[model samples]
Target: MHNIPIRNLSARLVDPFQREYYYLRLSITDVCNFRCNYCLPNGYQPHPERDKFLNVDEIRRVVRAFAAMGTEKVRLTGGEPTLRKDFVEIVENIADMENIHTLALTTNGYRMAKDVAAWRKAGITSINVSVDSLNSRQFHRITGEDKFDDVMRGIERAFDVGYQKIKINSVLMKDYNDGELAQFLAWIKHRPIQMRFIELMQTGEMDHFFQRHHLSGQLLADKLVQQGWQLQPKGRTDGPAKVFSHPDYQGEIGLIMPYEKHFCTSCNRLRVSAKGKLHLCLFGEEGTDIRDLLQSDNQQLLLQARLFAALQGKREHHYLHQGDSGVRTNLASIGG
Candidate 1:
């Protein structure tokens, strides 16, 4: 609490590898309604207890500390962040922070239909909707729920609520939704939304899931190019997605290959799980517990020091292919 002075806007959380992190993916809760086969298998139990999650005040202070340290963007994630009762209040508080220039959200789009208007009013810059399969029956099979109709309605409601640039995220699986690539491309031909085809990662339950359904995102992109779609650069410097748009269509497409192609060199984000654990890498097993540290005295300085220490040791790239990394918690438990 007595050493380095707070640098405010000029401060950057630089890791030993020299990558500066200015984006924070804050998980509000680990509780989710949908039980996706890829994220949560039959026996997997997420953070089912609400009391264990960080309180609204704790969340506000944590974000404020990061904001002071030059966090320009904050994306609210969760098992489903909108499932939390204080979802609106949390967004509002983050929006009020001076240093946060952009606020984005990633959701399964289950409850977004009912809350899109509130999200629009709260200054949410953009949204990423995880719609794995467009087919109703296959959607139910993959997600273990029949909310496909509801999710589609939510995406439509987001457009109606004035969300200009909505992104659709679909995890490609070999035997699952892989056959829908052409269908997905056709569906977005005239739509304004950018559909991103993500490579299925080897996360928690995904080890077994990968055996039956691991499709490469690069192959899908090749097919798009073969079909005469112009792969123009998106010019976005922040996210991991390699975005491309076509001249003939109104919509755009992207590919996120965290497994096949790791973009860790340009990785500039940190994740805070619902239980207040600060994760330097998405696949990292070690993390600093902010929940306990926040309860300590001289919170600002303490948080600053701890955060800086965490950054100093941030790994250059996550060891996903290595056996050590696959033994972590469920993907839903980590964040969306």
Candidate 2:
């Protein structure tokens, strides 16, 4: 597609609330193999009527536009991004862009042991793996995958490669893995991993499940503070995680509490679906299609104009606190 000259692109993507976006989460696919109870309990279903996900060229054009508009970080997400045969090629294409400094990835970690080194060489600067529970049985119950040992091996394999520190994402749920926080902390005490605890968020399809299992992340934050863990300041491109560090532990704790007051104040990221639809917020309205503008390099100016117009309508914050999850039925579809 398009490779508009970088110098010709001079506008930065900013919202009405004055939030300048510097990070872009681009989903490569919505097909995940794991059956996480919270996200895709039944497994990923393909819609025959929908168009196919973005190809390498289309993705390159999208990232190019963002990079020229001052987006510095790009996170390659998916139901599992590595599942694509062209995943490495996609990584290489974006990694070679001019203004994008950080090329990160979020995965389920099933293939990390087999393909991490190749990914590192292709320009993946950081990795975040989903490790819901330390207990094998509990993890299986949560993810519906019996490969917990294999996933843990994959993490160790990551360390063996060149990753100085890896981020671990765990969705905390009531009466599920909530009681195992101590076990998680002990495991990461001597490691360089950042354990991120995300509160279970409600989606359109998971109302009853949310009512049954949702837990507040503030409780964990309060506990950490009482235990002498000091809160760390966030970086410009950091996600919505309140990180905590301790004097004795090598690892850090991050709390992602969507229900917390002013949780969206530090919002600095935007999302684009696998099919090239820009999503203004995680829990906002349906996405705006931009695939037509990605077909040729001549459409770069129009695509940038469309992006700027869309940002003007972005809501100040997500409606999660008001019991509204917007059009999101599951996180997998939007690369959450």
Best by TM-score: 2
Per-residue C-alpha lDDT of model 2 across residues 1-336, encoded as one tens digit per residue: 334467557579988888999999999999999999999999988978788999998999899888888899999999899999999999998897988989999999999999999999999999999999999999999999998998899899999999999999999999989999899889889999999999999999899999999999989999999999999999998988999999989999999999998999889999999999999989998999999999987778888889989999999988899899999999998788
Over the stretch 219-332, how does candidate 1's per-residue lDDT look in tens digits? Answer: 877887887766665332267887777787778888888765456878888889888989887787667887876664358767877888878887778777564454465777
Q: Quote the positional error of residue 236 for candidate 2 in Å.
A: 0.2
How good is model 1 by TM-score?
A: 0.92
lDDT of 2 at 54: 97
For each candidate, the alpha-carbon lDDT, in order, equals 0.79, 0.92
Q: How close is candidate 2 to the true structure, as a TM-score?
A: 0.98
Query: TM per model?
Result: 0.92, 0.98
For model 1, the superposed segments whose C-alpha errors exceed 4 Å read 1-10, 43-51, 230-237, 296-298, 323-327
What shift in Å separates residue 332 of candidate 2 from its native position after superposition?
0.5
